[model samples]
Target: MSVRPIGTDDEALERAALRDRHLDRARTRGAVEDAERRHRAEKDAAAGEHGIHDVT
Candidate 1:
C-alpha cells in the first residue's frame, strides 16, 4: 500500500460536515415552505366559510 499524509482524513471529514450543513438547510427550507402552504390553505378555508374574498 502507498503511504498517505495524516491530514487527508481531516479534509474528508470537513467535506462531509459541509455537505451535512447544506442538507440541513435544504430540509429546513422545505419544512418552512410546507408550513406556509398549510397555513394559507387554512386561512383560505376560513375566509370562504365566512363569505370573504381576498382583496389583494
Candidate 2:
C-alpha cells in the first residue's frame, strides 16, 4: 500500500482549513434553520387545531 501526505504546502493547508470552516458554518446554519422550520410548523398546527389561522 502507498501512502501520501495530506497537504503538500502551507497554502494548501490554509485553503483546506478555510473550506472546512465554511462547511462547518453552513452545517450549523442549516441545523438552526431546520429547527426553526419545525417549530413554526408545530406552532401553526397547534393554532389550526384551535380554529385559529396565523396571518403571519
Candidate 3:
C-alpha cells in the first residue's frame, strides 16, 4: 500500500469514523421508525376488533 503523510492519515481516519457514526444513526432511526409503524398497526388492529376506528 502507498504511504500517506501523518496528517493525511489522521484526516482520513477521522472522516471514516464520522461517516460510520452517521451511517449508524441512520440505521438506528430506520429501525425505530419500523418498530413504531408495526406497533401503530397492531394497536389499530386491536382497536378495530373492538369496533373502534381512527378518524385521522
Candidate 4:
C-alpha cells in the first residue's frame, strides 16, 4: 500500500471545497431567479384581474 504526501492532500481538499462553494452559489442563483419569475407572474395576473397597469 502507498499513501500520498500531505501537500497533495491539502491541494485536493481545497480544490474540492472550492468546487462545492461554486456549485452552491450557482444553485442558489437559479432558485432565486425562479422564485422571482413566479412572483412576477402572479403579480401580473392579479393586476390584470383588477385592471390596474401602467399601460405604457
Q: 1-56, model 2: which lDDT tens digit per residue?
A: 99978877997989999999987897777975787889999999999899999887
- Where model 3 places Cα greater than 4 Å from the true spot, the runs are 1-29
Clash count for candidate 2 is 0
* TM-score versus the correct structure, for each prediction: 0.49, 0.48, 0.46, 0.46
For model 1, the run of ten residues with the poorest summed lDDT: 26-35
lDDT of 1 by residue, 1-56 (tens): 99878678789999999999987887777975787889999999999999999898
Report the poorest 10 consecutive residues by lDDT, candidate 2.
26-35
Off by over 4 Å in 4: 1-29, 54-56
The candidate scoring highest on TM-score is 1
* Runs of candidate 2 exceeding 4 Å displacement: 1-29
TM-score of 4: 0.46
lDDT of each: 0.88, 0.88, 0.88, 0.85
- How would you order the candidates by TM-score, starting with the best? 1, 2, 3, 4
Q: What TM-score does prediction 3 earn? A: 0.46
Candidate 4, residue 7: Cα displacement in angstroms equals: 40
| lDDT digits (tens) for residues 1-56 of candidate 3 | 99866677788999999999987897777975787889999999999999999988
lDDT of 4 by residue, 1-56 (tens): 99867678789999999999987887777965787889989988999999988465
Least well predicted 10-residue stretch by lDDT in candidate 3? 26-35
